[model samples]
Target: MGFNEDRKRYLAGLEDKTYFMLGDEACAYGAIFAGCDFFAGYPITPASEVAERLAEELPKAGGLCIQMEDELASMAAIVGASWTGGRSMTATSGPGFSLMQENIGYAIMTETPCVLVDVQRSGPSTGQATKPAQGDMMQARWGTHGDHNIIALSPNSAQECFDMMQECFNLADTYRTPVILLMDGEIGHIRESVTMPALSSIKPAARKMAKPGEDVFGGEELVPGITHYGMGQNVHVTGSTHKANGMRDVTTPHVHEALVKRIYNKIDDNREKIIRVEKDISQNGQSKIGVIAYGATARPSLGAVRAARDDGKNIDFMRLITIWPFARKQVAEFAKNLDMILVPEMNLGQISREIERFVNCKVVSVPKIGGVPHTVEEIYDAITEVAS
Candidate 1:
C-alpha cells in the first residue's frame, strides 16, 4: 500500500521491484520517499550507510544532507530544519544515539516533528562495530532522561528499513512529535527484497501551514499540532515553554504546563491511530500458542511459528512495527486470546516488560544479550515449553 501521481513524481525513477540493499541504503531511500528534504547525521557503523546514501541522493533530490561533526549537532540541525518546513532525519548507532539524547529532549520540549534512525550495534560503549544488538530498545524510550513519551518503530528486514521510515515520517507529521526508527546491525546489514510502494497509497501530509504575513499562526499554532507551517509566519519557536503562537516564556509555570502537557497529549490523543502491530495469520483466532516479537527477533519468530505449527501446536505470531506507544491494545487482545505469550527480543525483556504492564495475563520473556539475535529454535523452545 503506497503512492500515486504526486507520489510518482517524487519517485519518478523508482518502481515496484525486488532489489537487495543494506538497511541503511533502504532507509535513505525511505526518507526520500517520505519527502525528507533534509538529513543530518554523524557517521557510525551499521548506520553510516544511511548517511552515505543520503549524501549522494539528497542533493540530487533537491534535499539537503549533512554529516554533522557529532550526533548532538546532527540532531539539533534536524530540529532547525523542521522548523523551516522540512521533514528531516538523523541516523546513528548506540553511542551517537546517546549523544542525541538531550537534543531529543529538546525536540520533545519544542514539539518538533522529525525522525531519528538508530541502527543499533553492540554497545554500552563501542562494544561491537559490526554486530547487531537490540540493546537500545529501552534507551529509545527512556534514554533521554525524562518522563516524556515518544514513538519508536523497529524494522526486521531491509524491506522494513524502507517501509518503516515512511511510517516514521507519517507518525511525526500526524503527531508533530519525534519518531525513532530503531534497527540493529543485523537487520541493517542484511540485504533483502522490497516491493515498491503503491503510487496511490502514498499520500503525504504537509506540515499544516500559516502564511508568512497576515497573522499566520493563531490559536491553531498552539502546543498541540494545530498549525504546521506558513511562509512569513513569525511563529515564535523555542525550546522554552511557548505560548499558542510559539514564543518562549520560561519564567511562567502555566505556559510550561501547557507546553509539556501538549507534547504528551498529542501522542496520547493519537495513540490508537499510531500503534501498529502485524500478526501472522493463524486461522480463526484459534492459535494454540503465540510468539510476541518485534525488530529483528520477529524474523526468527516467523520460523519458530511455522515450526510450532508443523509440530502440531498451531502457533501464531504478533509482530510490532511501532514499538513506543507500544501496541498495547493489540497485544492485550493477543494476550487474552492466545494460550501463551512469548516475547523474544535481543535485549533483556524491555518490550516484554511493557506487554506485561498492559494485558491482564501472564507474559513469558525470552531475552538475549551479548549482541546476537535469538535463533529460531531458541524462540520455539521458549514458547513450547511454556505452552506445554
Candidate 2:
C-alpha cells in the first residue's frame, strides 16, 4: 500500500490521554502516536517492554508488529518497511544494538527514515543485561562505520521518553535519515507520571514525496524527498554511492564524495534545528564548573547541580536532549567560558572524551559502571573537586 493509506489506517487509533507509565511503554505509545505502522524488534532486557507493548497494541491499532530473529533482521526490516511509505521503528539494548550497527549504516547510506531505540545496558558484551549504563553513548554515534552523521536524543524521564520519540519520528521524516532515541535501563523501567498532550498539539511530519518529474533522489535540498518503492517514480535504492537519480555509481570518486557529503550536510547543516539541550546556568553568570550529561545520567547530575548551588558552589548544568551530531558548536561555546567541565556518565568517560576535544579547560570525567547510576552526592563531589 502507499504511505497515505498506511498512515490513514493506523493513525486513527492513537488517542489523547494521560497515564502513569514506564519509559519503555511511553516510548512505544509515542511511536504509535507519531504514526508508526510497522514495528520489527527482538526482545532484550530493559528494552523488551517496548517491543512487548507494541506487540499487543500495534495490532489493535491496525499496525504490523514482528518479532525478528535478531537485531540485524529487526533493523533491516524497518528500513524495508519504511520504503513502502510507512513509519517504522525497532527497539533493543546494547548487544542487540551492536548487532544492528551494519544495517544502521545501511539506513544512513540509503537515507531511509526510521527510529532505533537503544535502551542501554552495561556491556562490552552482555556485561549486565538487566542493568542500566550509558556506555553506549560513543557507540551510538560511531557504531556504524564510515563518516556519517545521525540524530540521537536522550530522555531523562518517562515524559521526555514519550515526547522525544515523537521528535525522533519528525526528525527522521524531516531529514530523510534514521534517528536514534538513546535511553537506558534505569529510565526504561522506572514508572512516572506522564501527561499526554492533546492530539491537536502533536504534529508529526508527513513523508516528503518526490514530484512527478523529479528524480527520486534529485534536488539541491540537503534532504530531498523520496518516492516509495512502488510509487511509479524511478526508484533505485542501494547502499553503494549513488547518483541523484538513485542509480549506483561506485566507480566514480566524485559521485561517492557527493553522495556522502550530502548525507552529512543534511544533518550538520541543520544542527541547530535538531539539537535540544536544557541549560541551568547560575543567575550570577559566574559559575566556574559545568556539568554535561544526557540520558538517565542527567537526572542525578541535575540534582547535584541543585545541591551544589545550595552549598554555594558556582556550578551549572547542560542536559543534552540531542546526543548525536555531538552538539559540538554548543559545547564549544559553553566550554570557552568555563574553568572546568565535568562529564558524569554510567560509562568510563565516553562522552567526556568529546567534551575534552572541544575544551582547553580541565575536563573531569566522573565515570561509573557495573549497573549503578552515579548518585547525586557523587556528582556533587566531582563538582567540588573541580572547583578546588
Candidate 3:
C-alpha cells in the first residue's frame, strides 16, 4: 500500500509521449498502468488489441502475458495466478465474455482479486464483431448466474479509460473481488491523445497485506480487504458459496447471511467514496429537460444538450462513470423538479429502467443497438424531437 519511488519511476518509464493509442490499446496500457503484471486471455474483438499488446509489452517489463486456448482457460488461469499472489487481468468481447461467466462466478465466490475487460460489441450471440454495442451493461453485473453484487465501471473517453483503471484496481484490491472494466466498441476502437499520468498522482493502491492465516477478511478496519496469500494459508475456493477463508460453507444460515451481507456491506460502505457521476447542472434547477448518458453515446450527448439549449429549451446533462451499482441517490437528488429524464444509450434501455425505479420523473429512452455510436445529429434531433 505504501508508495515506492522506484516502482513509480518504472511505471512512468513505460509511457511514451509521442505515441497515440486506440481504445483497446489504451485499455491494455491502463491495466499495465495500474500495476497488473500478469495477463491471460484468448483473442476476441474488438478487444483483441488489448491482449496482443500485453503479449508484446508485458514481458519486456518483467511481467507475464499468456494467450490461452480459449476464454474458459483464460478465465481459469487468471484466478489461479491471482491466488498465487500475482495481480492478474484478462480481456474479452461478448461471446468470450459469456464463456468466462462460469469462472467469473468462481472468482466471485472465492473472493479472488483480478480484473476483466470486456470491450463490448453488438450481440445476442456473436451478433456483430466490427460493430459497436453496449448490450452488456446488465450482463457485466448479472451475467454470471447468481445472486451476487459486483463492481463494474464504464468510461466514455479514452482518458477515462486510463483513469478508471486506477479506480478499478483499487476496488479489486480493496475488496478482493473481480472488478469489471466495461467498454464498448466506440471507446475501444476510437483513438485519442492521452497525456500520460504521473505515478505520484496515480499510485498503485493494493489490498491489505496481512498474512492469509492472520485474517483474509479483516474486521471493520480492513473490511473486505485482502490479506496477502502465504503458504499454509489453506484458502479453498468453490463456486457454490464460501467463508472468509474461501472454503465452501453452504449449510449454515448464519454463514450464508454473513457471507452475503459482508459482500453487500463492503460495497455499500464505499459507495460514496466509489460512485462517480459528472453533472452539467443548469443554473437554479430551472431546467425543463435533462439527458443522462454513458459510454460512447456521451460524446454526442454533450452536443445534443447544447443544441437543445440553443433552441431555448432548458436542458442539463448527467454522465455516468460508474455503471454497475447505478448511482440512484445522486440521480434521485438531481431529478427534483425536472419535467423528464432522458437516457441515450446504444442498448435497448438498460439504464432507463433503473432510472424509473428511483425517480418520479418520466424516463425517456432513446435507444439504438446498431454496433455503432449515436450520432450527435441523431441525439440532437432526439433532444429537440422530444422537446417539441
Candidate 4:
C-alpha cells in the first residue's frame, strides 16, 4: 500500500468538529486535511506553532515532520521531498523566509509542488520578531530575483488560514509550482473558532504524474507533469535554464526565452481561475468610496467599512484572498464605480502602489506600522476624512 492508502485510513478516522485554535494551528490542520505527507521547517517566532501542530498531527496520519538545521535547509528539504512525490510543506517568518528565497527560486524553476506558510513578522533585518506586518507582499512576489510569477494567498481569519492552506496545496499541485499561504503574526497568534471539514468530504489535489518517456519538465501543456525520482524514472532536475526533458540548456536564447515565458504564462494564463477576492458593494451604483485590504489588516478594514455603513456611508469594500497575480482585473473593475480606494496595510504602501497601476481612482494607502494593527477607529477616520 502507498501514501493514498495511508491517507484514506487517516482521513477515515477524522470527524467534523469545531475547535478554538490559533490561525497557525488551523494552518497545520489544513495541511493535514489537504494530504500533506511531509513537513520540513525551522522554528521561528510566531510560526513555530504551525510546525509544532504538524509535528503532533502528521505522524498520526502516517506523515513525516522534521525540523531542519536552518530555514534554507528547511526549504531545500521540502523541495526535495516534493520530487519524491510527497505533498510537502514548511513554515517560517520574515528572516527565515528571506533565507529560503534562493531555494524557493529553485523550486519555481524545477516546477515543484509545495506549500509555504509565511507567518509574517516585522522585518528588514528582524525589526520585531514577535510583531505583525504586511511588509512582505512585494517580497513574496519578487524576492527570488527573477521574472517568475507566483501564486500567493492571504487569510484574514483563523478559518481562512485553515481553508486557504488546503487551497494553497491544491493550487501548488494543479500548477506544479510552489504556493504560499501568506499569514501574519496578528492572525497567526489570534485564537478563533474553526470548524474542521469532514475528512470524507476532502478532495485533495494530486499532482499529474509524468508518464514514462514523456517530457516531465515541459511539453505541449503550459504546466507540465512531474516524474518522481523513485518511480523507476531517470529524470534530470536542475536550477539552470532547461529543456522540456529537464536537461540544462542555459545557452540557447530561444530555449531560455520559451522556458521562462511558459513558467510565467502557466500562472498568468490561468489568472481568472486563480485570483479570488471578496467584494461587498451593496451601493454599487451609488457608493463613491471603497476600501481594499488583505491579511490581518482586512479584519479591521471590514469593521471600519461596516461602521461607516452604519453611519449612512455607502462605501464598498474588497478583501483580497489571492494576493499574487495582483487581482488587477478585479481591482480595475471594482474601482470603476468609485472615485476613491483606500488600501489599509501594515506596510507603508506596497499594495497601494499596485492598486494605483490598475485603477484611475485615487488610491490612498492607509499605512500603520510600529508593530501594531490598525484600530477600527483609525481606519474609520481615514474613510470619514475622505467623506468630509
Clashing pairs in 3: 132-371
Superposed by TM-score, candidate 2 places the C-alpha of residue 318 at a distance from the truth, in angstroms, of 0.8
Clashes of each: 18, 0, 1, 0
| RMSD, every candidate, angstroms | 3.2, 2.1, 2.3, 1.4
Q: lDDT by residue for model 1 over 9-34, one digit each (tens)? A: 65766756667788889998988888
Pitting candidate 2 against candidate 4, the one with the higher TM-score is: 4
The parts of candidate 2 lying over 4 Å away from their true place are 1-16
Query: Considering lDDT, which of the candidate structures 1 and 4 is the better prediction for this target?
Result: 4
lDDT of each: 0.80, 0.88, 0.81, 0.91
Ten residues in a row with the worst lDDT in model 3?
A: 1-10
Per residue, candidate 2 scores C-alpha lDDT tens digits across 1-388 of 2224444455444455668999999999888777788999999998999999999887766689999999999999999999998889999999999999999999999999999999999898988888899888888899999999989999999998888888999999999999999999999999998776665676778878888768666578888888787777767788888899888899999888888998999999999988987898887989878999988889899999999899888787898888887888888888778888999999999889988888888888899999989999998888877777
Ranking by lDDT: 4, 2, 3, 1
lDDT winner between candidates 1 and 3: 3
lDDT of 4: 0.91
Candidates 3 and 4 compared: the better one by lDDT is 4
Task: State which candidate has the highest lDDT.
Answer: 4
lDDT of 3: 0.81
Best by TM-score: 4
Task: Provide the lowest-lDDT 10-residue window in model 2.
Answer: 1-10
